[model samples]
Target: MADKDPASVQTDESTGQPEKSAQELVLVSEVLPDRIPVMPVYPRPVFPHFMLPLTFSGEKFLEIIREAIEKHNGLLGLVMISELNEQNYLASGLHTVGTVARIYRCSQVSEESVQIVVQGLQRFERVRVAVREEPVQLWEVRYHYDDRAVSVEELKPHILAIMASVKELLSVNPLLQEQLKALLQQVSYERPHMLVDLVSSVLTAEPAKLQDLLETFDMRKRCEKLLLLLKQEIEVFQMQDKIHKQIGEKVGRQQKEYFLREQLKAIKKELGLEKDDKTQEIEKFEERLKNLDVPRDVLDVIREEIDKLKMIDTHSPEYHVSRNYLNELTLLPWGVYSKDNININRARKILNSDHYGLDDVKERILEFISTIIKKGSVSGSIICLQGPAGRGQNLGRPLNCQCPRT
Candidate 1:
């Protein structure tokens, strides 16, 4: 997939020469409002999509908006607030990197409210927050520049790889696959900014992760982060597919058993030797049960039930009940208790040795033991929990159960 040259950079085909002058690095801080009230777009914290329209309703914010409109180039640092609540907006944890957005349109909705639409241009990092008495906040920002320039040829392979991975991930959903294919085709190579925007739209990442990318001034790092995110998405799809297949097999087995029962009934009616077939099937099931290596107690009960079933008719109630019991017994976990040894001396030594600064834990254990002695006899079992295991054992009879006098 080749990217078309941006309109700004493209030259006349007839001239066969470079068309426009080299684009200048536009510094966005010059036009930005010095002390503008920042209103965070709550739902979309990271600005991956188009410019968002924000309302400035407070007295301080209204004045800031009016000043921005009057200047014809009021730029405000569009920052994301860390926490939003009724009391106050917590902007302390706000990312130092933010876009210096220029106000494009402004309209007065009401006496106190003003609606403003701003277009984000370039990224900036907040350097310092100046102390001020003005209603709005003021911060000194520096232009965070990305000097690395990637040529059109370099980006082609990367863009192609990204498109291929996306297609594979969305193959299960027809609608998403088509939409993603069209999106990849429409990306303009001439405008690297447009390509950046498109990649952001297609990938779904957490806000914190995206913020980390936005803070990065390096384009190479940004592309690497996007690739890593797409790879993670592919892994998620594979895990989901495995889970679906496992569930399907369980359902298939149940259906197979039901179908076999229906076939057996028809076979009995068609054949004249119905009694002989029934006797043979019962004998086969009994042999299989006896061969199974199960505990003697459970095996004895199963043998008795099978003997009773053989005496009853093939279509009798006893025969069906015995079949269900055998199936349940075969599925049970027999003689499978995990062996774990409880060493009281080792446990006590481990608890006291591992932690050097845990005086409270040691004190609590001593207090518990004191209570046990005062009671003459412990009422219930004592559980000594070590890590994941909870070991319980009864204390043997003692000559002196009462607590000793201090």
Candidate 2:
């Protein structure tokens, strides 16, 4: 396809803008050359119908830009560097297919660095290196065009689907609206290839995938690939939204619980009931441990349990279990003692009053009472009684009554 005449008043093919004269077009390309200076960009590939701002510091790149602007009608091949090689100026480092761009504006930032804005014109295939030298390198290239054109009726379904996906994307992501609004306004269903390029430039896909889109000249295939990319983008955004909402809801629930708990505390304080049950229980444990003449280790264990009970939440199951354990510990007769004033006559009278038969058992009990009277303490002695159920096995209760302070 031939380049459009710059002098004619027509819609700008790249931007779809209204009538503009040759002077406004900036670079008036009367005749395009096969061999033009090639500049390599990194990471991102520039697509046609888009403006790319580039910065150059090295004298080599600056020389290339000056030559392209001065002699080649501001036309140059903008190719993407496949990998960030130290020798990026070499032709081998750049992709074979590149965009033919015109220098829209150029300005010098510093003595060493220069900035240039370039608008992509069309796609081109680099045939071979026409010149490779110290200051500048030029490549012979063949221009490519959009192949297999399809009418609006043929692509109506895909166009509508693409529009729906784009609207969905805008609804989910507000940041993209301002950037894509003007570009979408330029989109036309008749120009399917241009629409494909416009959408491809904004996709959050890998550089290789986008570069493939740049290389694809088939109109229908490019649109299909774009549709797939849009669907994948939508799924990614939807999942992100779901995860964000879930996190927000969880945080909101926790905040509500905290607020309610604070309100309850304030209410209890106003009613003079703010001592809290857990605090009162802990204080009681401390008081019991202080009064009882417990052993050193027993006191230490009880104090440790009190500290643990203070740290635990009052409403948890573990808290109740720990409180019950402390209660049992404090209830034990730690230092309570009974006097050793055993009366033989009183014991014999109580045993006769309690049981009628078992004369041998009565004699054994009298002997044990005699032993305790001499020993002064019942240490190292245990009495064992065996009997069937409901057969007077509770004889020990009456025997215990004989002791005055046991």
Candidate 3:
């Protein structure tokens, strides 16, 4: 698609008119306002209730904005450039139908660009365009907006269908979960035409389709078309999600197979059944062993076990046990020691703070700790910790988690 002209930007400059959604439509009476400034939107149709923010450039549009704000107090016209004939933009390039919108804000975004916040006031058809030698265009339009009266009962089924489809779509998409939930709630009490228009804002489709929806003046038909669009969107999203999941699973399976094949290759090389450099495995083992800080006796024992492991056939059951033993040996803290910070005063304070009437236990713990300090070693293998049933009876079992059999 071709880029839209720089003159085609929506602008707004009013505040505190009414609390409404950018998607909520405002009712318009038959009273016709006179000539207003025209803004041609080549991009998308600004449906009723659309509070659209846009960026625009070009000096002609700026002049229109100036006249609209300074003279007319933020009142303007917007006609979408869709399937129209050879009508000149500077002369006549719009339909008899257009919108009367307000400028909520107009800010100079850059030297070449300006941002404008616009809200569609109401539909106005039977417009007469006024061209000028100057870079501005104006429109004299009459407001045209009316919808057939719709009973809530007649709209209930279609509304329920749309809600169900939206819910289903939202279920699969977690990112939209909270935001869509609020939007769905807001759609509940709106009129049928307003409800469909609000939903069109949420579910983006082709601009042409949106133009069709904006042209629909019947409330019942609008709801029906909106429900169909929602169902179609839901089906498309589901199919796309299924395809994505299938592709992901296929990729994962292929990756797993690749990893397994690489492992098998290495294993075959290690068993001297392949042509690859088989010594890399033993080199890796040697490098790992040299980095350890084991006692001399333990180190010698591990080296002898490694040699035995190299000579033995790995298919035997004894191979797994030998491997597990080596793994356990590597994990052991060979020369590590626990340095407990012990002070008699701090210990007394801790004991008193932790428990009342445990003076005897505290004294015994202090005496044992002193003996261990004097010896410069942990002298006992098992020290009984007496406490309430849940406090100490089986607390030390957690220490068993330090190593596992495999």
Candidate 4:
């Protein structure tokens, strides 16, 4: 195995940092008693990377620790375990490649408990796992190191682009901008691998996605992935801005319409067309009804409600008639809707299987499923029911109610 100092790498001139060192590496093999209980780390934890310290309390872990302490080397392999069952982790098989880590610190918390800090060094591929009486897993490991080095001139353009994207994203969020700016300054510009790790940590991708990037041995491929991630972050922020603007426009229109209606009502009362300022604005609605072209049946309903509103005070029953009429007209479906097909029996089965009690709630959910299954889909309709209220409670009607007519 070749032992080279990482600091000897060349620095990127533009960023003033050391370049990445390209050195072929070897993985050392370690033995773990199969009975010692082995935990495989799916995500690769790198050396000098600050990760949450894990506590190993199981009997197998204790046995493994005893052996490591006795051996004096204190070196262990970190392997990624394949999940066999979603709920059970012990049944999963371990992945072959894992980083060989050396214990930096170890402390005994209790008679049966042990705490240790291990720093990962290099990557290794596992050949096989053999069971032993000690309850610890034995791993056959082969080290693979990258010896290909790149100069500062080769990585400047990519680094510049990455910095620009970071700046753009930061402009939208000033707090994040400051943090990113500081990180960029602290990072050595010459070493692309370090930059890759730093950028990948901050990206919006999930932990699993980031792990995949870390496991990728190709330096160029890793940089490409990080750049792509940065581009996606920029696009997401832009889409969010567009959505906010659209919502603002919609709200502005609603506010303007409300203000205009109130002003028109005041003008009508002053001109004596309305009997009182408080009287429902039936005349205004009637004029609007005449301007709008619709089916005869809908027109007839609107005209009838307008006539009723003119005879009643603002607080009378007829006042609600006009309000309802306008609401119904404005809220009608102007477009077609594809019916949703629901399976009531399947829904009932699911509800029963997932929950313990609440028969009424389950029944209501099943009813809704039945409706969707029957009609394929229900038309847009509003149904309100008044229920008993408790202090600080806002319980609405149960969902079992049949759909109201549109």
Best by TM-score: 2
lDDT (C-alpha) at residue 393 in model 3 = 23
What's the distance in Å from true for residue 201, model 3?
1.4
lDDT of each: 0.59, 0.78, 0.66, 0.59
In candidate 2, position 120 carries an lDDT of 80
* 1-406 per-residue lDDT for model 1 (tens digits): 1122254455569998657655533344443333343434443343433365788676767765664556435666667655555465433346666666777788889988888887665566676875444545556666553333666667766766666667677874344677566766766655555566556644556766767767766666666777787787677767777787888898898889889977786688578445465566666666666556678888888777767766778778877877677656654545443332233344446556654655776555545555655665446845354543221121211211222111
Misplaced by over 4 Å in model 1 are: 1-38, 41-49, 52-67, 71-74, 83-86, 90-92, 103-118, 131-135, 145-148, 169-186, 237-406
Residue-wise lDDT of candidate 2 within 216-326, one digit each (tens)?
776677778888888888888889889999999999999999999989988997898886788789888878877778988988898888889989998899999999999
CA shift of 21, model 1, Å:
2.0
Q: Candidate 2 — worst ten consecutive residues by lDDT sum?
A: 397-406
**Model 2, residue pairs in steric clash:** 338-405
Q: Worst lDDT window (10 residues) for model 1?
A: 391-400
Top of the candidates by lDDT = 2
| TM-score, cand. 4 | 0.45
Q: What would the C-alpha RMSD of candidate 3 be, to one decimal place?
A: 24.8
Cα displacement (angstroms), candidate 1, residue 404, comes to 62
Cα error, candidate 3, residue 42 (Å): 3.7
What candidate 3 gets wrong by more than 4 Å, as runs, is 1-34, 83-98, 130-134, 146-148, 172-179, 185-187, 275-406
Superior candidate under lDDT, 1 versus 3: 3
